[model samples]
Target: MAMEASMVKAVIFDKDGTLFDFTATWGPWTADLLRDLADDAAHADRLARAVGFDLSTCRFDPASPVIAGTPGDSARALEAALPGMTLDAIVRILIERSRDVVPAPAVPLAPLLSELTDRGLALAVVTNDAEGPALEQLDGHAHHFAFIAGCDSGHGAKPDPDPLLAAARALGHAAEDCIMVGDSLHDIRAAHAAGMRALGVLTGPATELPGAEAVLPDIGHLPRWLDATT
Candidate 1:
């Protein structure tokens, strides 16, 4: 199970679901953000209809290419409720609240990240979160990444190749040389679109997504798979 630095130039991680528990990391913040969105004149009524103060299952739709996890559903619901608000404004609010939501070390990140870095494999995070919270999680880690790319930092979010491509470039590596580990189809789709290999981790439950190079139980098994041919 030892990992070799030569096998992986860099490891690109999907933040919310893969590196950290999506529900544990984002659930409370999402609830608060949705409540705030509900208070807004533009979104209050619509958000009430979507989830009615319950934030657990209130995600953007699973069908949309623009959306990713259940967290995105709340975001999308807010956007739907508020017709004319700029995407920038909505993303800004979500990102700010996410700063208070911290990832649990129980998710098993420190050692793997340190091991990867120790082996000289560059580490980067490519997430759908806007710039603010993305940086917040990275900042909370005493170990730093070579690059961190957020949705607001580029042309588009997950399922789009831009953010993934940007992360690879920031690491000074080719997309083909990076291993993208995530918990959603959007992560798989984005990595594939960028010509990279992806590993899907079922930190939540089983999903019907296809296209990733492999799927693992969680981040704990990821490092060993960097050289996996399957």
Candidate 2:
């Protein structure tokens, strides 16, 4: 059930699987990028040698519940795979390539976001992605958010309290006064670590998610949950 608005000052969200269909949004881009990489003899060999997976045989396999991790740690994972490459360079490539991967706005997540703003609730995004793609996705939904921050934006990522805590601070609210909404257990854990409540949505594969205050079907039902809470 949704908690009262009086009990919640703001809402923190995770991007990707939570807001939009992850596969529909990022899968194509990943597939195309892998294809392009595989087509390059050097990069193809690197993919086989580094990741031990052939780029050509790859498909954009959708992963379960999206969560967050430490910014530097997460970045390092991507960077470590591409030795000697600057983080900035890698992030730029990912962001540029991701442009071809469009979000499924048909999910009506944008309207829900606008509704949250209209309800006078503060909003922010704390994603696990690098700052570049994070901002690009947010700006793509510019009509929705009042403030958006990413794990790479400096505070931290999910599964740690830093990101949620920073977002609460930015919204001028206490952690207890904010609610974290996402599609993963990592998000739920993060909210708990941050001293906030969590609402998980089943928009993504549910098996990978952790516990939450409530688990609903998707963001579209969030309004109803909010109504129940209020």
| Per-model TM-score versus the true fold | 0.77, 0.76
lDDT of 2 by residue, 111-181 (tens): 78788888888888877766676666666675565557766677867788897898888889988899888
Estimate, for each residue in 1-230, the C-alpha lDDT of model 1 and write its tens digit: 12222346778888776777755665566556656766564454456455433344644333432236323544665676767676567656665667788675425566777887887888888877776667767675635587787776755788788888888888899877887888788888787788787778876333654776667878887666764652
Which parts of model 2 are misplaced by more than 4 Å?
Answer: 1-6, 39-92
User: lDDT of each model, Cα atoms only?
Assistant: 0.67, 0.66
Q: Give the range of the ten consecutive residues with the poorest summed lDDT in model 2.
A: 59-68
Cα RMSDs, all models: 5.0, 4.4
Name the lDDT value of residue 109 in candidate 1.
65
In the predicted model 1, the residue pairs found to clash are: 59-70, 59-73, 60-72, 60-73
